[model samples]
Target: MRSGRLGLSLGLDLLGARICSFDCLYCEVGATDALTLAQKPYVPAKRLLGELSAFAASGPPAFDVVTLGGLGEPCLNTGMDRIITGCRETFPGLPVAVLTNSSLLSQAAVRRRLALADIVLPSMDTLVPGEFAALNRPHPDLSLSAIRQGLLDFRSEYSGRLFLETLIVGGINDTAENLDVLTDFCRELRPDRVDVVTMTRPGAYAMAQPAPPDTLARFRAALGAAATDGGVGHGPAALRSRVVDHKGPSSGPAASPHETMARVAASLGRRPQTVKQLSVALGLPEDDISRAVEALAREKKIQARAELDHVFYQG
Candidate 1:
């Protein structure tokens, strides 16, 4: 059940708890319930190893990589190095990756810890201090300068596949000026590949809207050669294919409309969730969840709330 989002990756909920430095407005995992800057052992290595062992013992893993991130920042865990090592030891030859918000990379120690990962995916939504504050809403102590320096330092030392991601919101960061600045900085950073993604999923803020297709296209064009449409893999198809090709297709039938509605309603009645979270929870695609959400909204069975540009569905 925990294995959802970004297909083909064995997503380890390393934090198993919410402990992030940034309370980003567009976080799909919901608002930062307990924010902190300290890195400590949130989940004991023994417990995490046990879970991985149990999962592997159950059957062959239907994943291409072992992703060390879930509800919160993976770097926040003091034992991240141990977890990465353990995963490698448990699943030999499986690439280990970590998706970071790039908040903790300012510290050389943090960068060294991430060196073990085959792929280090760090997000840089915006370089401007004002835009960064409004979008990422990082901890008070974190500065734009420090973050920039950290990325630069990490790029220089880290010798792995350094993939970068930028989340764009319509009015917040889709401006021509902002795109120009981002293009310049990304070129300087020299990432192996860059993903120019908008808010495809719901987030903590109402204003977190996705950039128009044309706007995204322009943004990609501006980012120059390294820019790509998809975030981790080239596109959703590319991400899904990694799993489908390895495990064959999912044998289970798609949920019926009535079943989908009932499940969606049950989750919304208890609490609001973004389409992405709903998709992950129900083991359905985002497109299916979107259609169900729209149908429910039209029937007045559920309500949608906007935070930043992302919408939360509630019943």
Candidate 2:
């Protein structure tokens, strides 16, 4: 599917389950099941590489980037280094990206593995400890200070593109003080880009609401002259602060019913979407999307929720 930040991207599910270091309130993949910091080969490197080779041989559509992220933090997988290397060997010329929750980056070993990727997207919602716990619900052993220092250390050593993301949940991390602290850290870290985003879909917690548009606007304005031009769907720019919009049309050719159902399931796993949104995103007719949604719901692969006057489906 086409990502707003990475464009046409293919995702690699290194962790097959909902295991993450943080049970984030705004997690679109639902609540975390195994919330821990222990790093091990959840999916063996050799197995993942073999799957990658097989998938590539099937003549899949062209994608701009190969992303190592699924329902959980990709960094928690101990085999990430091998997977990154394997992805490069399998799909030459395509940039490899990893989406991490910035929880395990505190470990030097994790940082070393992450350095293998061409682009690293890590999120830091709030710098305040209280806000951090309230929003992220991080593991008991994970400290905000350590995570912050780890980001600094990674910036000092890594040469790849680092796009730092901050998801501002309404009344949680959207305070002026928190934004100020986040701005200061952004200046210190000097990431290639800074994506300020809010919830656009159903979150794990019912109380998690999207930050007001004015709140996001003020935060962007606070970035001042330091804010660069690059935002969503654009190339890298220095310390660019802008809201991320993931809504975009799919790029590949028309898909059959079975293929459509697979795509729909994958999309819902990433974020909740209504029938209309699914129709526009998948480039399929509303009838096709509705049929797929109904089938998926019957199969218990996805669930529907009524919110904001529309029924949204999530996987």
Candidate 3:
């Protein structure tokens, strides 16, 4: 709700050196662990450096931040130091930002390596171990106190803006007891701002519900003073940017840009469209289109209907 009065870019996401630190529980790309560490030559150093060079030489929207997000944790990417260095060389004035889970910040080497960034958005969702495990289901090695102390330690050293993110899952961690403890933790971190977010997309765990609007309102009011006199807190910035991984949206030689479809019990707001019609209209290969449709349905992005043996889709 409340935030900085200082002048800052209120407009772009693709401007400079922006990076993400952790692959999260609610990540759109699926399991944070599946991509693993340095999952391949994916996001190689030289390649990203080149993109940074081109963005800097052009200026502004050419790039502004080197956000370390996408499918996995950016800190885990062994080449992170190199990536930050290249970004710095390419655009010395550009600020670097990292969006992360805060779990890995406990590692000294990791913290030192991340010092290059101008802003860091680190999130801690729970204060109790059982609650933490139930929600984030993080790697076995991490614990609540360690993660909390790591954030405090990193904040003590980082010269950049630190915005701590905490998503309020409805009915899960919104209990009064949880809020009291988490608030105390935030008091200790004393970050620049505390962000509150809710689910906009479907999640892997069906029980992952967004906190209620009323609860979010209460959180904002409760945290408002902290933001005003102590610090600032607001909703999260849009979930980073589109990943450069996919080779553009799949399209054919003549037909339209292929659109993704999903399955739901009831259509949310969109009109109905049949798979056969979607296939012909979208020009996507039949099999690929089918896969896309099923995936969307799983994500609850769209609704499905069946008559006789045929199934239809609606957003």
Best by TM-score: 2
Best by lDDT: 2
RMSD per prediction, one decimal?
A: 6.0, 4.5, 9.3
lDDT of 1 by residue, 1-315 (tens): 112334566667667766788888777667787778888888877899888887778666666677777567888887888889999988898888888989998988889899888888788888877888888888898988898889989988988877777778878878777887888878778877776777655667767777788888887677745343223335322232232211212325677787677778875664467887677555667787788899999999999876535677888
lDDT of 3 by residue, 1-315 (tens): 125422121111221221333334454334443423222334677877776566445534323344655434566655667777776676566566666778778889889877777777787777876677777776666667888889889989987787777777777767777777777777777777777666544443557777788887666555544542454333244323221111212421322223333211121222244555444333345665577667777777766875324576656
How many clashes does the backbone of model 2 have?
Answer: 0
Flag regions of model 1 displaced more than 4 Å.
1-7, 226-315
Indicate the residue-level lDDT of 24 in model 1: 83
Candidate 3: where is the Cα deviation over 4 Å? 1-25, 33-42, 54-64, 227-235, 239-315
TM-score of each: 0.77, 0.86, 0.66
**2 or 3, greater by TM-score:** 2
TM-score of structure candidate 2:
0.86
